[model samples]
Target: MLCANSAGRCEFDGCNKYIFYDNITAKKLNASNVAHIVAASPDGPRGDKTRSYLLSDKLENLMLLCPQHHKMIDDYVEDYPEELLLEMKKKHEDSIREMCDLIFVPKSERVIFFSPIKNVSLTHIDNQLTAQALLPQKRPASTCGINISIESAFDYNTSEYWSDIDNQLKRDFDRKIGNELDSDPNTIFSVFPLAPIPLIIKLGYLFMDKTNVDIYQKKRVPDTWKWIETRKTNSFSVNRIVVRAGSNIALIISLTAEINPKRVTDIVDADIIYIISAERIGVDAISSIDDLSDFWHVYQTVCDEIKNKECAVETSVFPAIPVSAAFEIGRRYMPGIYPKLHIYDDYNGFCKTLTIGGDC
Candidate 1:
């Protein structure tokens, strides 16, 4: 039961190493140690006079630790205090139990796609963080997920730096993801994207409506990959200005912050304009999955607006949105129905990063 609870791995928080065998050599190895949280002996590490006797051999006071951690904690009792040890042990066991419950639950392949935002402070995606985010709804499939990393050392600000980003995405994606889709096109993809708006949108665009995708937002405040435990409701307003009939229509999404009209006006010679803004906008505006659903509902309407035109009007998308929303924008863009999109990314200034549905 103890080994099962620890999932046959070390229970020292981040040190979740497997102890079954030498993975590289394929040799049987006793790589684990049964360590007492409150020492079985009174004078041992974290030993207590009364509690040591009470908890000796008790499952509650034991942890499945690797040999190294077992020795290190014994060596320095101060650093690995009783309370901290118990916390680690409890968290590890509870997490393991929760994971066990999800053995039969649906699995989602963690699709990781990221690029540098502002050419600084790139975010790292680990199974530890993404695993915590996947609970209650899906099981973490890190071992089998699709990973396509496109973090160029080149400056994101320079137009020349991004010329081949789409091509690279296609090449890597076709090599890894396209083959997977050919076998099982219905595979559920849990996308964790932290890239420029254009690339994420393109990522979503590539997936299209044909593929199943779950977008995970990286929250700014708590700095977590998990969705809010409870859904927080938000309200949005869609305002449109149809100046005159023309070949271009401007679709401006201002969710995180407001985008000045002049920025779009200077670049796009549009006859019609549509603005989708939240009642309250900020980094935390998109806090729940329901909020994304709300955006999707609004998004379909926007897509229909473009699709129903007498002639295919080219769409200019100027976005001030969270990464998740940008992705959805791409996912929903159907070539035959929706017009071509000239997606603008904010760097030093708005430079066209990608074009969706341009060919068809």
Candidate 2:
């Protein structure tokens, strides 16, 4: 096979020809020279035949460059010292670090907060399924706006159509609902640090619950029910949340009306745990609250519950403390929130942009 390093076009400034092999043998003629995708010797030219970086011959690591950039690096080597080269390498490494942690949130130990699930509660809509356990017993007079769940909606074969729905939801939310809230993309869309555990795993055995879910994107709502035409098996639960490198972190707040004690006890199984960065619930729509403030509010609420009534709910946050704040916390729990996280190396390219529960 052709040497991958010499097979490609050069990225070095002002270079345009194919790069040659490294050996510089006489049989091949004295025509071409090797260019490093990353630099080797600072004193040498860009594609200097004399030098080799650590990434020289690995197929995924090499690049080809013409002679011009080779000369430029040779001339500029003194000005661009080793420190500068090292800094550049670190910058690229930092870019792809996926700031997410994925672990199973057993149904028994997940956090639950008390708040109206919708912005405007309609009695006519309330009457439709009021008898089921899924609906909240009493609707609050205030609105909680909308909850965005990036739960898995479909499989790979269904990807094209479902993605269209996802896009439409995004557009509708941005153009209409976000405008009314005075929110920009940064405020409306965020990374939910904790991912949902697969429903099959939580059920613990072969069981079924039929319910309706109204999917919301911004303000547009679409109704979906689980029991009508589909089935779930015990074997279907998944253990990981797909996260991509460098996505906005979202602190997912999952609320369930009925208190289940076993859920809180399941915190031990989580692979990544996070603290409440911030929270905002039960506030007026006009509050203009940010996510961090929202996190704090939720944190306070949890503390109050623990102090007074002893709520069984527990919270797990992820990506550990931000890299920027390592010194202050030093990998310790903010309070006694149990089951803290062990920060793994940033996620690989396998990271996903959204968390999709395996159900649909």
Candidate 3:
């Protein structure tokens, strides 16, 4: 039962080594062992008092662990104490249950064609696909040159101009795309980026953290669209803590360069804090997909910390990161397990909140 509860994998934190393997010849090899949270022997490590009298042979006192972890815990009882082992067992069991539930739920699929520019056309796409357009109210009849007539179609060359349009588009997306996601949490959204590159980045920022989505970019020659996947990045370290005052929220920051220290100091009162600084990798911008993957690893670690806590989560990014990396971050957040995400946006040199999911 313990192995089944752990989904046939190791229960150690962040160690998902599979215990049961079947080869092509149909021979099964098992490398898992049931480790007792409370030592079975009276003279064994962590075997004293209550454990000696009770819970020694009980199923509730056992945890499924890989061979290495089982040996390590037995060798170093001080590090893998009874309390910590019990907590890890509970968390791993809970995660398995959640995964089973998600596997059985039904999912609906939809394709969204978002074109905020004039020159791009979606007419060649299949008519059977559900198409939602975001065209301007009016456009010049002439087809000789590219003409943009959108309400917020401002110049993207200037930072101020792009920021204003980005904000406006954010509001628009919250109303339109956000509504669709709210209707069905299991909806598979396939998005095609046909707007300005900056707007595409803003579009990624607007996607509610944790929602399932796929991004695609168009290729010229034969005009084919390919799915873009976020690759795993190199590992990064984090500094995390849990506070007990103010808003019951977890703050996760990934700094590629540097952010305003004042902004971080302002939120020290949060229930939990997780900071992943750029100093770990010594890069201002995320140079590879591996960096983004590394960022995601830390993000998930922070998520694990606050999973059982009754609090919202706020993720803040410092300096500036690549749009692709931002998109990957938004994609990784699993809305069902994680609480509502409050993303911070800087407006007029002041931090503003952008709520994703949860009563927004």
Candidate 4:
């Protein structure tokens, strides 16, 4: 019972090594030792006169451990006390049981997308990191990644480059994502997006909500794409700067990182320029789905204003945001109600703009 509960592993606090084989040699052997939490004799390590007599031969006092850990625990009785051993055994067994329960749970499919960012030569999303992020809570459907990235001419900052990428994304998404949904309409996807901010948005737009999708953002401090719980999520602020009142609206999104208004004003001329920034702006500003929903609340407010006034013919967007937020922006955008999006990317310095909602 003890061995089965411990999953045939060492029940030591820090060591859960399987004891079914020799550690050094490539040979199958049972290296398990059944140790007594309360020793059989009163003089033994952590021995008690009553417990040694009562629990010595009982299942409650037995622990499945590796040879090394079993010897160490018995030799160093003071360090590995009866209380500690009992706790460790319980924890190991409970964890193993939990894992067994998860075997029947359905797993989420991994979807990866990558692109070349200017000045940043390295753009790789390690599969292990993505897998680790989806742990005890969510399991991966398969080790194979549904890769949607296409080869390019390494030609950024050109019309041909943008044009080629735009078509490639649509084609691959149709082939990879569309075909999958056709076979099984109820598939769940966990999305890991690492691409140019504008392209990430476009990818989100193409993806839509055909299936249940989970968005992942690569964090800065804990340098991974896993979501962490912060003391507080992001709160946004909207600063309206109306240069002249006509029909043109310019939006500056500074959530993942802050941006200077002059950067947007210098190139694109607009009547009313909106600066929507997070109260605490940085890479880790957003922590959960609620945070992203909060951003949409603010964005929707701006949209409501635009729709109410009914003057703005088009909206120019200059964004310095996270991949998740950028993706959300594209996904949430209304092509019929909202005006066309003139997107200015970080790279290319205002050259070769990407157009969304106006792709007719």
Candidate 5:
């Protein structure tokens, strides 16, 4: 099933060479190699004495690859470690699974247009099937001219604006979508985000683990929109805590030592603080699994504390964390209860550019 979904292509990043080809003689040539994440032999590259006994021929330890990657990983085991290979295998398989699900699932004919931001024209959302528009109370003339009634609105300049209306937005989404889903559970949601990124992230958090929804973005091309897919899963098990520094604010727990606590504190004012040094640090980023696990533990602890109310959360990433880890943190947000994140970029010793988490 996995190989079929992959279409006989190599799973390595940026290496999509076909595994099989037809020769001029009409012969079907096979060039695929099943690469083991752990070496089959104790003396082989990335070899583990225990893994050789347990997973030497296990299918779970194998990944389909072309001859090039198979030889490359085996010859340069230190460069292509076991953990990295396992991550690659999981992502490739997940991509294939997502593609298959999209093809097999029968999507509902109804399309829900949820656009709070007043950036795109409503004509872009016109399509077959019944269409419903959810817009803000006072939007620009372009979006205001639509047939939908205004349900909500927010200030784009205010930093804490999302915090005030996060709950309202979630309730609005549930009230509207709940009735729709009751009629047809497979209804597709085509969201157009013209609001702050945090609100968009909150919109997604509302649908976490409940529905498969598609968000959309308007391209530079006039009157055009593109579908955005959510790939991160909401399932996570970790402990959370609250390091109180002040009211309605929390810090992103750092497991890497590269994040200077003093520098972070100087940039964002918060009532709560959670700080930790990395177990193993890198110059540009932290890629250690052990370190990421520690960070997740701390993140869950904080989530447990703040999963009950809307708060203004500030996160400062120092050194740097893995993209996957950051994404997992975003995915774990508990819908209406999750805080409005104020993400910062540490540039020249200042926490700059507050990016609210969202597709917009």
Candidate 6:
């Protein structure tokens, strides 16, 4: 209840302040009626005595505000920040002086802590988290981090074994390329169709991704190989083969150019043959596909095992047979050996084969 005396004296502990009745107007005046310190709707039409207080004397809800002070609280409460209110409440607890500082000559003011509502950027944070989690998984384990040993096997032809390995690499490369090309028909074949050549040569690194390699290699190939262009002059040519992979072994060949190297190279001038095979080494961080570091380290290991001989560069590219001669022979005598390729070449670009054909 509001503090008022029998003679309408303000009974609040504050110094005497008396409310008087207007004798002429016959209206009794005193701080008796409960006043809402803050109005929920302050902007409503002012001075309309019909404006009602929301609650009275639940001390927890009501305040002992004079009429003028009541209006002031109402006006400011609309834009008040919850944090500022909570801070004011914390400073006012159990201390009249602090309460008076928060209010004007007050008894007590209630306290309330307003929690903040935050709007987070979910997409941005999620993307950052995803990158952090996935990057480590994608990284290849370093050789130092993992332990693996390699041993040499006595085989009839180390070159043949190497060739088989090269064939496996090529098949894998083609499969990967095929999967990528299924989406776009206009995309040309992979540039390194020669397969394991690129891996052994360290040139395959240029074709890191299938899409990029296809574009580059396609541009490099000439139609002359598929369609031989013979002028008035006869030219000597060479079929340069490149084998590549992450492994240390490689096979490359530069054969006499009668097969019309115009599509790839004009002359098989320099037969650059380098083979770096390994017998007992470690394989670490070597991708199953065209991997040069693996090839290099393995080559070194193989050379060391062979007492560091010059020919120990182990992997060598050799011309198994002349391309034209093979085609003619297969076509004439062993028609069964060669498939009757349609003149309308349906070559769907380079693809990985399941098996590396020995005869081809």
lDDT of 1 by residue, 95-208 (tens): 888767989988778887777777765757765677667777888655746778886666776666676677788788788778878888877788888778888888888888
Which candidate wins on TM-score? 1
Tens-digit per-residue lDDT, 40-92, candidate 4:
99999888887799988998899999999999999999899989999999999
Residue pairs in candidate 4 whose N, alpha carbon or C atoms collide under 3 angstroms: none
Please provide the root mean square deviation of candidate 4 (C-alpha atoms, Å): 7.1
- Candidate 4: where is the Cα deviation over 4 Å? 1-99
Between candidates 4 and 6, the TM-score winner: 4
Each candidate structure's TM-score, on Cα atoms with residue i matched to residue i, is 0.73, 0.20, 0.38, 0.72, 0.33, 0.18
Q: Which of the two, 3 or 4, has more lDDT? A: 4
lDDT of 5 at 331: 44
What lDDT does candidate 4 reach at residue 262?
Answer: 79
Tens-digit per-residue lDDT, 1-360, candidate 3? 777889988888888777787446566688779888888776887887666658777878888888999999999999998889988888989999865765644332333334444234444343222221111111111122111122344433344555565567666676656676688666555555445433454456466556666454443533344322235334566676555555555454555444544565574345546666654433333444465667667767766666554355544333234344446555555656766665554333424334444444
Cα shift from native, residue 201, model 4 (Å): 0.4
Give the alpha-carbon lDDT of every model: 0.81, 0.28, 0.56, 0.81, 0.51, 0.27
Candidate 5, residues 256-282, lDDT tens digits: the string is: 235555566566654455444343443
Question: lDDT score of model 6?
Answer: 0.27
Candidate 6 lDDT, 159-264, residue by residue in tens: 4434444454445435543444465533432121222221222123222323322111111133211212212112112222333222222222222211222221
Clashing pairs in 3: 210-333, 233-290, 233-293, 234-290
Candidate 5: which stretches are off by over 4 Å?
A: 1-105, 109-164, 186-190, 221-224, 227-360
lDDT of 3 at 300: 71
